[model samples]
Target chain A: MARTLITVPRTAKRDEIIEIRALVQHSMETGYRRSSDGDLLPRDLIRRFTCRFVPRVAANSNAASTAGDLIFAATFHAAIAANPYLSFNLRATTSGTLVFSWEGDNGLAQTETVSLLIA
Target chain B: MQPSTQALQKDDTQNPAMLWVKDGEALWNKPEGAAAKSCASCHGEISRMKSVATRYPAYSSTQRKVINLSQQVNLCRVTQQQASQWPADHESLLGLEAAIAKESRGLPISPPTQRQLADAQKHGEALFNQRVGQVDLSCRDCHETLAGKKLGGNVIPQGHATGYPIYRLEWQSVGSLQRRLRGCMTAVRAEPYTHGAKELIDLEAYLAKRAAGMKLESPGVRP
Candidate 1:
């Protein structure tokens, strides 16, 4: 399993800027390196990361119509270190769930979600 | 240690070794082997293991020998979980060791004073001071006498085992104290002891005593 650690405030005041941190485990193996037997090690890495905020619908509003706002995204390359970590700032405008996903080589895809409350 | 490297170790998010610690935590609670028992099944909460790492390279009555944390882990796996022993420096082994040691973070190194452990420590001290290998240099020559001085591009820090299962940039992974010692012996062109060798355990025992009262920083990030 590709384990990940994420940090986000459990609750924040409206419009407050909060820091979010995400760390994911991966070898991020570069294709250039040769094995001890001199065979080239194939490249394996997480190629992309994205975080989106799915805003909570009001009691009277249509939940199905709610939309997710893209908060951050990045494209990782060979130069990125193993167990990549990314930290970003987000404005707490509404109560919502933050979705984090990673897509990578070898058909790797992982997604995790954490809830947040804006008081 | 350089300030930047120290900073890297201090932050959990930036430290790559923490990935192993996280894996270890998961392993602690997950069931394994025929009995389907996890470390938590018998040990209860992970917090129960706190301060346990401070006393290691301990004498084991069952094995009738001195063993380090990794050996103790294997013992539990075989005896309690009925699982096969993990090879030395295996990711799962390193992860479990890292997780256990992390619980003792900020606690002093407190090697036991049992007679068998004492013997191992003494032997280890002698080995540390003895000249060996093609270069005819002992560990003391560089880690003790020349510590803080430059050797090529790197500075030789005191040979303390305070932080282990350390995340060495060179290795690009978490490694045990035994693995690091083997690397050093090889660097000196010495016929290095095999993994889990008694001599290596002895060295680890002595280093534990040598570093007594120093705080542990397992899963340490090193340059």
Candidate 2:
């Protein structure tokens, strides 16, 4: 499994834009490369990544909510180096959790989340 | 180096090595050793160490030899801090080295040029050009003659020591120049030198002199 690192501000003002950075540990093996034995190394890379912001809802509210709103997403390629890194900006509207997920070839997948407190 | 890797180096949040730097910062203030003297107790503010790393592999009158920053740190640990020496390439040692080097970032490489160091520097120059191992390749073969060319699908850099205690993506951790040099020896199938070996110290002297004008980028990121 690929290890991940995520960075998010611990606190932010309402409607403020905050930067989020993420990185994952992966070989990002491009099939174009050959091993010492002259055999082709199979391709393995994080093909996709997504970030979603799930706003905190009031406890008394009965509003229906799902997995949060998608804030950012990216599609990667084999050309990406090992340990893929991604960074983006998100506008904070309310206290919420940011969910980051990555998917790769050969069923490689990993997810991480961080909380953002708005004052 | 790839553009992406360079970008990672500039951004602390994205640079995995920063994690170690953070640990180093913590260790700096925290007391350790039998004397309970933390690095801060002696070194005071880290800012005082700025540009200190630029003049390493210097001649130590007491030791009667050239000593790199890592060795100096070990020396302090043993004598001043009253602590046992951390083994070579230990994470804690690398962390301290990274912290010290980080302070000197962007400074020029300026290893000492005293008369005492002349002989060791010559030995280092010879080692740099000498061919070794089954492949019979010398550091000059690639870093000098074949630099800017492809090697194993990656561009061969000038092999400057400008950035050390670097966070190498391959190793997925920060490491010292000696560790990287050992890796090079292994790549050429040569007998690797033990850490703190005189031969390695001599080679470091040569590299420091060769990279004299280059900027320091310790805790640098590389692919």
Candidate 3:
């Protein structure tokens, strides 16, 4: 699994705007540079990141609620430095799960889930 | 350092070097080598090794010489783990060093007071003052005499070794103090000593003494 760090509060007041930070380890090689041996380095990068919110559903509910609402997203480019870090704000309304995903070259896909309680 | 860069280093979430620290934590616990032992088997949790980085470039009785932390680490790999030594400045090695050094973050640098180590430090002091290379400049010339002066677009910093395994912006990666020292030698058109050389270890010893009492900021972000 790709090493990652995510910062989110465990609880927040209703309608409060909370900040969430996410960082992932990646080289994000641009493929432009050449090695000391003179060979071109292959491009490797984290291309996209997204966050989703899924409201808690009652137990025994037969709802196939797979996809969650998109909360934030960004598309990265070659210029992005190694170990990309991003922060965004979320309006807390209800208790739910936050899903974070990173997609990148070299089949790099990682997902992490965090639950936030709204009081 | 720019305020923005300082801000980056201040926030653990923003500092890229933390990634290596995290990886090092994992490596510390995970089993490896013929002995099927992890660092944790002998050292326990990484946090338990706190304040260890402060007294490095220490004298070694077994080797009858002064050694830096990296050399000590490699010695463990060879004698304890029965594993091959990690090549100089290898990513895995850097990760481990960064992780280990992070344990001592905020602690004062405290070089061990051993006769052998003190001798090494004296030797290193001579090296720091000796003029070399086509530039004919000693480390003291710029780091002491010309510190804070602009060289090209950058201001020279007072040479201190309070941080190692720092995340340098120029390299876009975490690097060791030896790497930085080698770069400085190259800048002055001097031939750098080989990694793990006694001269480099002596320099490390002197730097540790020079930076004594200063807080360590391993995995420091430098521009």
Off by over 4 Å in 1: A63-67
Is model 1 an incorrect, acceptable, medium or high docking prediction?
A: medium
Please tell me which model should have the higher TM-score, number 1 or number 2: 1
lDDT of 1 by residue, B1-223 (tens): 8898999899987788888999999999999998899999999988899999999989998899999999999999999999989999999999999999999999999987799999999999999999999999999999999999998888999989988999998777788899899999999999999999989999999999999999998879888
Q: Write the per-residue lDDT of candidate 3 for residues B139-189, one digit (tens) a residue.
A: 999999999999999889988987789999888888988999999999999
Q: Which runs in model 2 stand beyond 4 Å of their true positions?
A: A1-6, A9-17, A22-89, A95-119
Instruction: Give lDDT tens digits, candidate 2, residues B86-201.
Output: 99989888888888889999999997777767777889999999999999999999999999999989999998988888999887677889999999999999999999999999
For candidate 1, what's the RMSD? 1.6
| Kept native contacts, fraction for each prediction | 0.35, 0.22, 0.65
- Which pairs clash in the backbone of model 2? none
- For candidate 2, report its TM-score: 0.76
**Comparing 1 and 2 by lDDT, which wins?**
1
Clash count in backbone of candidate 3: 0
Task: Give candidate 2's root-mean-square deviation (CA, Å).
Answer: 5.8
| Candidate 2 lDDT for residue B86 | 93
Q: What is the lDDT of candidate 3?
A: 0.90
